[model samples]
Target chain A: MSRFARPHWVEKMSSGMAKPLIGEISAALDTLAATGVAGAIDLSGLPLTATDRAELEVALGSGEVEAKVTAAGTSEIRETGFAGVWWVRHFDAGGRVLAEILEIAFVPQLLGAQGDDIDAAARRLRTELARTPERETGRETVHAD
Target chain B: MQIDETTPNAARSAASGDDRTLGALLAARGVSRRAFLKYSSYLASLLALPASMAPAMAASLAKAQRQSVIWLSFQECTGCTESLTRSLSPTLDDLIFDFISLDYHHTLQAASGHAAEEARMQAMEAHKGKYIVAVDGSVPVKDGGIYSTIAGMSNLDILEETTKDAFAVVAIGSCAAFGGLPLADPNPTGAVPVTELVTDKPVINIPGCPPIPEAMAAVLAHVLTFGILPELDSLGRPKSFYGESVHDRCYRRPFYDRGEFAESFDDEGAKKGWCLYKLGCKGPATSNACATVKWNGGTSFPIEAGHPCLGCSEPGFWDMGGFYRALSVPTGDVARIAAVAAGAGVVAGAAAGALHRATKSAARGKHHTVTVEELEEK
Candidate 1:
């Protein structure tokens, strides 16, 4: 009875949230496969116990692709063990999580560079290329025009 | 008088006659799509909307016009305004300013005297039924509202006139939502909440001593994205934020369930962060986002700091009972005598026991069932 007491503590800590959330993720995965429409679940909005969160993390192991986006603040987008499932977390300046979500998509939208940014990058590259000296040293300089 | 505009982006756009959609405005300002995505996700989470709604919300917000807002302050302290300004950081929350054209505000606006009043009137005339009127204080109606007046116009008169053509009304604090402290005991001013006067428009109440800044921001964002108010509870509060009681989300809930309560402020249980329920915590009865969204940027709430919740968001919180009196204990002579005896250190245990027995006996006798209709009538 004394040895079983330890396991009871673990059970007491559990909010019984991880199992249902995993089921939701599976359903979302099925939806994504069938209709090519991505789904997302806001983790921050739910009242997840610490033990439940740990269990969720253990279930959704890390995958290959991992990307960090820096805009107003930093954001981490990582693929989970499931192919179409990704874990996205946005952090404030103080590194506190502002929002977290489980995204079911081929690729999370934040990872892609926007068209406006691409256009701005092109103009910036052109300006930098034009500013380069024609014959400063041994390397040949290419004109932007 | 000078008119200070705090929201430079919206003001600048309005000044330049740039009638482009919000998406175009963000692009013009070099705001990246990633930032918009992040903000949309945050807003969606705050509003308790499904995560899939982030993209739709972002798209809707981008195409939406800046919402016109007219802020009116009446019989209350400036704590609500102070809380909003101080708690909203320059991160995603500040984007609320860019989404709304705050045509008139007493505290945040630079205009004073006739200039401020004229601006409010002009905004009302220009936007008509398209503008939102946000009020932060209770309206005193005693003696024709002579207690509080602005520009020789009583609060009741102003609230009635401003809300006549408004799209919606937002009661920003407990004062404006539930008549708050001013309508507590004795009721000298005959104060009443915004819902009492404005029956025509949708009145959304964000009832807190000072509501969570994020909640306020999220409500505005919801309006901007959906062109309508969020789902409201019976008390006219946003169900997303006020759906759960503070005790339900409190960190010390386990201690409460385990029957490990701190009997005193400096006890061993107190040091170990046990429950404060015995110390008159109103968390069990109070519904607000304080325990979750928190104050000072998710830092801590009153219960987290070892203080009992005052149930500030509820109607008539001030007159409910003594702040240090437990909810189970009935208010009036017995509790008052117990408190006085305890203070005097004169047989405190006996007084407490008597009080407990009195409460038990009272409970046994009073089997009156209160119906929803009866509660509503009260």
Candidate 2:
């Protein structure tokens, strides 16, 4: 018996007819100019084809900053060639793309969560300390150098 | 920031007629230049100015001299004053209030009787063609403005006499902007907004049941910084604050776009955090910064607290139809309107379903198959 499995549905690389990306970029720029605040375009929520993604990449190109942040999974942040604009992607632990976003701001809001993460770590540490055998005495007898 | 132990020397400044700049007063208050600049940046953002304008705003505001303001009260509930007083704790708004030379305020000033009247006269004379006149309530034109008065003077007489030499006037609340509750149906006292009376001087209307405190503070900042009133819309409101409707900036707009609406107060849709458009939210038509700037120091606003907007900032909102009635559904001939609305909704639904199906089929046709080898190559 043949063991070859049939290939299922796969997304195609579209013909480069994706011009709506230009409007999205323009709107983001307009918003930033009018309001001192920032806005985001969630590509994951849109029906963007592979060709559309490639076209957007060609238009914006790449920029300097590249950072990998960890939450439930890895979130990649890359600055676009356009000043004050960024390309961000979130991927699950299985390496499946979850979200793709184009952010326009003085600074991306994704980086502002370090303080909250620190607070979470503090709570976790306190919980772990409470379960220790020496915690009942409420005093530190052994010290680790 | 530290208190300089010297109470504001408004009396002395007025007596000597010395043009002391705001920088000098902030210096006296021990407010550092950096802190002042930070406050300026905050004000710039609050006023919706570009971030690059912060330094210029700071420089201009710093050099600007104290503005003599005369506050008149009439046919009002004192709620505007109460709202202005509820700024953030140790608020910058209070500091800005302190920076101004408030010459006469019936509710706030310690002086009563002839003393208050004398203060007003002196300040008006000293700062002729320079002072700002801020009125908080409606002026009753009917019956010779006899329904309200100050020191035996009718509200109308006092308003005309006081603003004769004033550079500009700021109508502070809905009462002063559009004749609030006092001018409701069967208005016997014949209360009218200040804009109706003060035609000579420029009037800026900060219309709200009780206008936002920051809004009032920002307007004062604009006057103190630029030496002019901020840009006004057709209704004489500051365009920066009333530029967009509450619905345009609402957080639940995505739900609206998805056509998920809450039909009632405690429905499953409401609990699911759906749009409140069907539940009488006037946000779509109401223009105000309550959805953005919020109240009580950037805290939750009415809509955020699950209450429909009452369109308080717009003129004549009080005379608008029932508060609980949706903007789409009018009060007159409800049965007819409902039937028409239902018909329109059905047609729209069928059109939307067809469009959605077309989009799905197009995506399917565009789809291509990839082998394991192709995935490995990528």
Candidate 3:
């Protein structure tokens, strides 16, 4: 493997320097793992075929966890015990790659000065989630965490 | 004390001829009155003043040829001068002929050699204590000011002599205002800001590579009309213009609040036009009214052009890291730290800001409610 391909070495690289491909990918891990807000990152290594890249985008962007139906037939969102998992990927300046996918679970917080509006809260969260740039930028059903 | 109405004096006539009106001045001479008024108001408003203040802004402008302004040029590309002259809306020509008296600008005026020196001395004598002194570029203080000189006089001596009895001093461009480009990294000339040299009078600093032309105009107007100087900021800049940062008024601020960022330069986020905060925008640290005041008569600003703000208006901006990297704040917790930037220095409790962005969004959702108990079962 080239000096740029090792994950451990990449992680150790200086944050300001021109990052090796793997090092660039590792930076995404740092940006995402620390923040719940998912970001698209780029990795120079592991050039996924166009078909594979599309499939991954669909899988990640698909809000399958949010779409899960509770055991009682209610929405997973209404279920207090529910949590959602998502992967944050890195992208280049032009949306190409250089990093590992950092997966984290999002525990939605109760909204408002008085948590009085549940449905309103749900719709609000839905919009925020919509604006979230998914790998593929679309919706699909998936499993909840 | 009654405000004395004697500023322009002989300085105005000498620098720009005895034409009070811009239309007549431009007509008989060259720059128009309407264009002059337009230029006057355009720059005044950039300071966040009312549009109606333009006429009053103009009347107070000292225009006597007696008002000698010795523009000291130093280690600079003269981009500020070029930028000043290229102002097309009202045009820089109006400023030169109609604004405060321009006595001896090396860039303009056909006088050369001993004649130029004589012209400068003549204007200084004619205006005396009433003239305005403006300095461009940085003054090198090292090696007894040996790095730069004019007529064998060091930039330091020239500055000291001229600023001794000036009505008010204006430090135009970043060079004079702050150390500017010359002060950037390993400065050899021992370049120092104007603040270091002048101790007797209040110095107005108009910082930027060349500074906004309107900023230069408004300062002249403020001094001419008010004569007591406009309100200054911590950096000694006028508060009217440097009061707010571009980030506070950016149109893409909402996107940042929502945590939506442009993924790349040409991706869907870029196509949709998302926030450039993630892309090394120095807007947050910068303090300038560029977003609200805009440029070229409300034409467009840096952010409006679909680029991240380089924060050129802020001091030592060039030394900052790359313009495409996001500033890293302490990630106390994803939710909590996000609130810090969101609350943005508000002490109403960190979570309050998060709650506000949440409540506001929740109120907009408008959906049917479901109980936690029901969700637990069906």
Interface RMSDs of all predictions? Answer: 7.0, 17.7, 25.1
Tens digits of per-residue lDDT for model 3 on B1-378? 111222223443544445454333333443333333334444444455544354455444423222345666766778777666665333332354344556677777666667666666766776677777788888999999989888888989988887777777888888888888788777889998888898897889988765776677667756655657888987888988777666666656555555566756787776666767656665665667666545554455777777888767666655544466553222223334444434442221223222322332232233222221222232
DockQ of each model vs. true complex: 0.33, 0.02, 0.01
**Model number with the top TM-score:** 1
lDDT of each: 0.78, 0.68, 0.54
Best by lDDT: 1
Model 2, span A1-145: residue lDDT tens: 0011011111244535457766767787788988866766655434454556677788888898888866434567899888778886655444544345677887665554434335545777999987886674555444331
What docking class should model 1 receive? acceptable
Clashing pairs in 1: B4-B110
Kindly give the stretch of ten consecutive residues in candidate 3 chain B with the minimal lDDT sum: B367-376
- RMSD over all Cα atoms, model 1: 8.7
Give me the TM-scores for chain A across all models, comma-separated: 0.76, 0.67, 0.23
Off by over 4 Å in 2: A1-145, B1-11, B89-91, B328-378
Off by over 4 Å in 1: A1-12, A114-145, B1-16, B329-378
Ranking of models by lDDT: 1, 2, 3
lDDT of 2 by residue, B1-378 (tens): 121212123444756666767766766665544334445545665676654455577678778888888889989999998888774434344557755788888888877888778778877887889888999999887877788888999999999999999999999999999898888777889999999999999999998878887788889888988888898887888888877677766666556655677878899988876767667676766667777666765556877777788878866666555577554322223323334433443222222222222332233224232221222232
For residues B215-304, write the lDDT of model 1, one tens digit per residue.
888998899999989999988999998987777667676666566778889999989888787787777667888887888767668887
True lDDT of residue B136, candidate 3: 85
